[model samples]
Target: MKKTSKKNNNFKIPGTELNSSDAERGKKESQSNFVELLPLEVTSKIFSQLDIQSLCRASRTCTSWNHAIRNNDSLWKSHCLTIRAVCQREIDDDVKSGYTWRVILLRNYQKSKVKYEWLSGRYSNIRSPVSLPEKAMCPMDADTWGEILDAELEREVEKLQ
Candidate 1:
């Protein structure tokens, strides 16, 4: 009886084998190139040019990028300020909480989006505040609610005419 080694049965691809030293060298060569090559200031400047969404995507690409993006509070602060232009009250409340710039933006991003929708009259026939998502209701006060309702009413009236 002949015993066949399980290792010998494994399939090997042609020309794909690398010795341990060669594999290590390949790993070194293929190591993430961007952050390693660019100066920190240059990398930060490049990241700063990205919009919020692009910055977020870039941050997820690697650990170095994540560190760069998260550590740079000014990047998040700038985005929060831009958002503030459209949703001042929400941003103000977030800023007052004394969270980091990243947290401030995270906390208010959705609220700002919802508030913009309300202000822009994106939803019609909002007979009650319950029609809105719970997160949307919290940042808004009675006056903002009234404004949304008034805008919705105006939209409905315009449709009738």
Candidate 2:
């Protein structure tokens, strides 16, 4: 007696054996957006951990991801709060004026960074505009200029003493 090995053909075309409704359902299931699979809180938690640039990139990847990121204010709030460390007055003013956290962030994010650099005296020694670092400088409000001036004055006073 000769023994023969049986081969299993596991590769099957999708919807081959299902009815029309079942095939449609299967297609929907297979094409379901991953962002929609998770609960809102779960997706928010996952997205909140991403850095600002990564979050923006993720939001642009697809409509579902943009919806998830855009609709959740908490993610933008947390990031805006971090920027508040450098731009407290601006952030507070915007918040008081009823600007959403995302809008506040969009308005202040780069300004805060530039303001921090100025406040931190990163540009204190520039002899002229030509000597300044090659970077994008956002327009700062008068109050921010005052703060930077104050920091510079304090440094000068310390030097004089």
Candidate 3:
């Protein structure tokens, strides 16, 4: 039978045993050192200025940030309103459906992107009705369709010039 040495038998897991220096380092690494130090109003104001992508990233950073972003419906409402300029009908539908501002934005953000691509003529061939996103056709009225068509025609005319 092989006998393990006493020194070898006593194993120290790297982080399980913390010396004074390690404890100090751990304290320094806490989220409260930065974000939590700010007043809630200040944090909300800062997050309100961030764009959708930045706000989403910030929400994932920590519990406090998530709470700040989630609880402030006005912040998400402002973003939803901004996106409404690009996809008004979709935003209206989402509002009618009783979705919260955050949910409304999530639901329409992709649809708005696709609609913008179509309006800007980013796709070379928007040939068939099937080629367009389902949501694009559903909520858009005849007037909105006319506007989109006019915009596309204007873009084509600009390209020709």
TM-score, predicted candidate 1 vs. hidden true structure: 0.62
Backbone clashes counted, model 1 = 0
After superposition, which runs of candidate 2 have C-alpha atoms over 4 Å from their true positions?
1-31
lDDT of 3 by residue, 42-118 (tens): 87788888999999998898887788788788889998998798888878987998999999988777767766776
True-structure RMSD, every candidate = 9.4, 9.0, 9.7
TM-score of each prediction: 0.62, 0.78, 0.59
The residue-by-residue lDDT of candidate 1 on 5-108, one tens digit each, is 33332324569886655555556556756776679889888888999999999989988889888988888999999879767766787678788889888887
lDDT of model 3, residue 119: 77
Better of 2 and 3 by TM-score: 2
Output the number of the TM-score-best candidate. Answer: 2
As for candidate 1, its clashing pairs are none
What is the Å distance of residue 99 in model 1 from its true position? 1.7
Give the top-scoring candidate (lDDT): 2
Write the candidate numbers in order of decreasing lDDT.
2, 1, 3
